[model samples]
Target: MTAFQPDLSSALAGSACLGAWAHDPASDRIALSPVLARLLAVPAEAATGTSLTLALAAVEAEDAVRVAGVLRAAGEDGRPFEAEFRTRPGPDGARWLRLMGRCGRDPATGAVTTQGLAFDLTEGRRPVGSDAQQAQRQVNRLADHAAAMKGLVAGLRNPPLARLVDEVAVEVGHELARHLRGGGRQVH
Candidate 1:
């Protein structure tokens, strides 16, 4: 299991995030959440059956691919699965949230089951466009860069890619050290 970061407990309690779904291949139903109603870009009472498809459509184009990849990984070889991603909510009063999920087998039918925790990230008081916001965006960008580099390393199997990954590691370490010294979140 991934580290449940410090914010998980509250995110689960407030319903600030969305959820997981157990794929019922037989009943054609998906088990999910109602607060996630807006997330699916639909009404609150709407069932979860359509949320996955709708969510794929509504997620920012850049992130849609990642979400799709994670969704695809869920049913592989019947292994338990998990994924995390963030999407900028639409105009609806929805707030920014982090989604964490777990998928497994259904008890009765042995079909795939999905159960997840939705974490609401609405507690920060940092002003938009403020120093904190800028730092947060920086951290996000660096994280994305790190992920891409890691992916490249996994695919290329060459010394050049390894060197690139090493460079990124050095940069990340330097940034993290600076943050620790300054009392700020690393790269943020």
Candidate 2:
């Protein structure tokens, strides 16, 4: 079983940042949070009972096949699945969504049900014009430079420079993490 991220516990518990769903294939009924309905762009009234066709239609065309495969395998094989895909949530360009769920069967009737949580990854995916994105770009450049330096340092066997480079790399990694965590200001 995939362990739930502790950082998501509060959000999932309150259905704030996360959406949860239970899909019943036998009855063709799906019980989902309002957030899920909103994410799928499905009407609140259409969230349950055979209206999944419309909801699934909201998924990006290229990603729909993978989504269907994961769901189908989960229902038939009782496996857990995780998928990340871009979705056209509105007129705005595509947004990223991460889905994590498990499937199970009724012992008596062999009915398959899949339950899972959804998280909006759009913000992270669309950092295009943000300070964090700029910082990330800088970090990427630093990483590439550091990799080249590592090769030179290894060849020259300069222990002191190698140690300094290692320390700098560690600091760069911390800075990158801070930027990703929304610490918008540059680290030194």
Number of the predicted model whose TM-score against the real structure is largest:
1
Residue-wise C-alpha lDDT for candidate 1, range 1-188, written one tens digit per residue: 23565576575565544554444433434445666655546555555565455555655666667755555565454444444444556775434555555557768977775545555455442356867456655665676678767875877779887887888867876675665466455453
**Position 140, candidate 2: lDDT:** 79
In lDDT terms, which candidate is top?
2
Which residue segments of model 1 deviate by more than 4 Å? 1-11, 14-20, 23-29, 77-89, 93-96, 122-159, 182-188
Q: Against the hidden reference, what TM-scores do the models get? A: 0.61, 0.57
- lDDT for 146 (candidate 1): 83
lDDT of each: 0.57, 0.72
Q: Native-vs-model 1 lDDT? A: 0.57
**Model 2: per-residue lDDT, tens digit, 1-188?**
13464555664655435667777755545666787677777788876644445667778887877876677677777777788787765764566887789898779987789888887776654457767666677777677777766775877778999999888877777777776777756565
